[model samples]
Target: TEHEVQRWPLEPQGSTSFGLSRDGRFALLYSEEHHLVLWDLEQNKKLATLGELDADGNAVSHIRISDNGRFAVTAGQMNFAVWDLGWTQAQGLWSISDALIRDIDITSNGEQVLLGLSNGKAIYVNLVTGRRLEFLAHREKVNSVAISPNGRFALTGGNDYKAYLWDTESGQLLRTF
Candidate 1:
């Protein structure tokens, strides 16, 4: 049996965070200088640079690429932007005045977004239909969030030491742990 190893040289910048496409074909790199770059992992080349300073003029602290690699979401303290990866363009940028965004995730088709907030709420947005739903399932800051592939369900974990699964459309609490 043989083992294979491959390495790609990245620029000598301080990377703060990164996300990879589910198929392992793309990489989203965030540097200390607030620079975001997309790399073609298989081709070993840079694909596109993404986003400016967030609405607050602060560095984006969180990044997530959709499972199918067609969408991406980036967040700062109180704002987030959704990107259409196929077009290499920003679909929308939004900010929340009442709560800070802790995490975000997008659907495979680039239409739905799930955002967990410091106000102990999870917000679901449908980009195409302009529908927004809120799920208030936690009592503390929501620290993590994820959405089902079909965009029907959401799971959120909060600083209150609880995790909840909820219906995205109706904001009904399905299960708690």
Candidate 2:
């Protein structure tokens, strides 16, 4: 398959990780020095660079951009935050107590953030209200998580050798396998 490649010629020189929004218009890049930057992929421009997070000072390990390009969530060893793209501020910032977040995905409509934790929990946070719904999905570490394309359901997998289907709105367990 032929694909187009995008490059950042002046991209900060360091180990960096980025998350692409579902629409492929934006990228949230985290550098080794714990710097977070928003890039406009469609226009090939740097949109915004957030100030250093003085809360924990830890490097972000993972990032996920919502489908509608409205939000970007980032997590590190001890911090997790949801950025409001419109305002360019972290709308919901948490000093996480459990283990680090292992993986993340956003609901199709970009209203919810699904998180997989190292402490065996699957959590989804509502961006609008900053409400969080959490449950013990596994006895061991949760390794992966994904939301249904319609934004109504979720699935999670973990070290416990099982997968779970959940209702996003009510945070109810629908099935376990």
Candidate 3:
């Protein structure tokens, strides 16, 4: 698939991940060296830069914007943090185990975040309460995780080569593959 392309070159501080807001109004590119640049896509220009997430030289694994574009999630090796798009610093919404986080997913309602750990366990955290929700399924290194659009269930695939379904509330195994 060949298509026309254009390029504009600018120097950004460090390694970064790009995420587009749900409404497409804003785009955020964050760097590993503790900086994030917000661009206004419609205006075709850089809007603002926030000196946030300056924790370590740890590379960011994933960046996710909430469905409404009001919240954002950033993942690093030791810790994961969530930010309000309107502000530079992240709100104290949730935190994960210091086990080299591999992946992160936010619910459409912005009520929960699912984190996949390098040690093979997947945990769900409630944004409002900052509590780790009960999760029971994976027995080995979890390779991937997904949640239903309605946020009723989660599916996980891992080194075990098995996919499992679990209830979001009770953390009970609903099915296995």
Among the numbered candidates, top lDDT falls to 1
Clashing pairs in 1: none
Candidate 1 positional error at 138, Å:
0.2
* Poorly placed runs, candidate 1 (over 4 Å): 1-6, 32-34, 53-56
C-alpha lDDT of candidate 2 relative to the true structure: 0.77
By summed lDDT, which 10 consecutive residues of candidate 3 come out lowest?
6-15
Q: Write the per-residue lDDT of candidate 3 for residues 1-177, one digit (tens) a residue.
A: 987675443234545587788787777777755466677776778767755553554556677777777666777666667777666556753445546677777776666777777787888777777577645466777777776655668888778788888877788888899
The predictions' CA RMSDs to the true structure, in order, are 2.5, 3.1, 3.1
Write the residue-wise lDDT of candidate 2 on 1-177 in tens digits.
977675665265764567888778788888755388888887888788874444656777788877677877777766777787767787667666777788887765556778889899988777667788887858988888887755678899999999999998887899998
RMSD of 1: 2.5
Where does candidate 2 have its weakest 10-residue lDDT segment? Answer: 7-16
Descending-lDDT candidate ranking: 1, 2, 3
Q: Local distance difference test, per candidate?
A: 0.85, 0.77, 0.69
How far is 72's C-alpha from truth in model 3 (Å)?
Answer: 1.0
Q: Quote each prediction's TM-score.
A: 0.90, 0.80, 0.77
Query: If ranked by TM-score, best first, what sequence of candidates would result?
Result: 1, 2, 3
